[model samples]
Structures are given as structure tokens and as C-alpha cells.
Target: MKITVQLFARARDLAGAEHVELDVPAPGRVADLKRSLASRFPQVSPLVPSLLVAVGTDYANDQTQLSPDVAVACFPPVSGG
Candidate 1:
């Protein structure tokens, strides 16, 4: 399955891309996607642990299943000075 992931802030900078398309196994979970992302973009690996993933409008956990029809957004933790 192919999933489109949206990158923001530091994640976009680390990936050097605003968006990325990943090919994962069928019925892949968010955790699986994370692993794939980390593998493909080593620069983003350190930030992956702090990143938040959203499926559609709702936030998702590692176990959340991914759907090709839906896009996933990856957000880096926000810090306000």
C-alpha cells in the first residue's frame, strides 16, 4: 500500500520535503509507517520519536492502522518561547 505523509516544521526540514510517499505492507500500522519513514529518511529518525501522527482529522497512535485512501500528517512537537 502507498501512503502519503505530510511533513511540517522540523520534520519538513529534516526530510527536505514537505510530503513523501511511502510504500508499506498491506494493513500497515502507524508504527510500521514510522519505521519505514525512519528507514527512508535517517535524518528524521531522531525526530520521529517526538513526532505526532494524525490520520485524517484525528490523532493516531502507533497501533493505528493506515489507509491508502487517507493522508497522514506528521507534526513535530511545538515549543513556545
Candidate 2:
């Protein structure tokens, strides 16, 4: 499955791009995406655990299933004073 991922804040900085296209297996899961991102973008490895993943407009968990046409958004954990 090929999915387009939108990177936000720290994720965007780590990836050096606002968006990235990833080619995953036909039946892919959020866990797969996490691993792939870490391997492909080493700078993002540390942040993967804390990333907030959204499949479309809804938040998704690690086991969430993914499709080729779906778009995923990754946001680093946010903190406000």
C-alpha cells in the first residue's frame, strides 16, 4: 500500500519535508508505518513512539489498518504552558 503522510511540527522538521509518500505492503497497519518511517527516516525514529497518527480526520491507534489511498498525518506530542 502506498500512503501519503503529512508531517507536522517536529515530525516535519525531522523529515525535512511537509509530506512524504511511503510504499508499504498491501495490507499495512499503523505499526508497519511506524517501523517504515523509522527505517526510512532515521531522524524520525525517536519520535515515532510519541507521534500522534491520524487516518484522515480521526485519530488512529498503532494497530489501525491502512490502505493505499488513505492519507496519514503524524504529529509530535504537543505541550503547552
Best by lDDT: 1
Runs of candidate 1 exceeding 4 Å displacement: none
> lDDT by residue for model 2 over 1-81, one digit each (tens)?
778899999899989999998877769999899888888899999998888899999999988999987879988987868
Model 2 — TM-score against the truth? 0.92
Give TM-scores for every candidate, taking all chains together and pairing residue i with residue i: 0.93, 0.92
lDDT of each: 0.91, 0.89
* Alpha carbon deviation, residue 74, candidate 1 (Å): 0.7
Candidate 1 lDDT over residue span 1-81, tens digit each: 999999999999989999999887889999999998999999999998988999988999999988899879998887879
* Candidate 2 residue pairs in clash (backbone atoms < 3 Å): 1-25
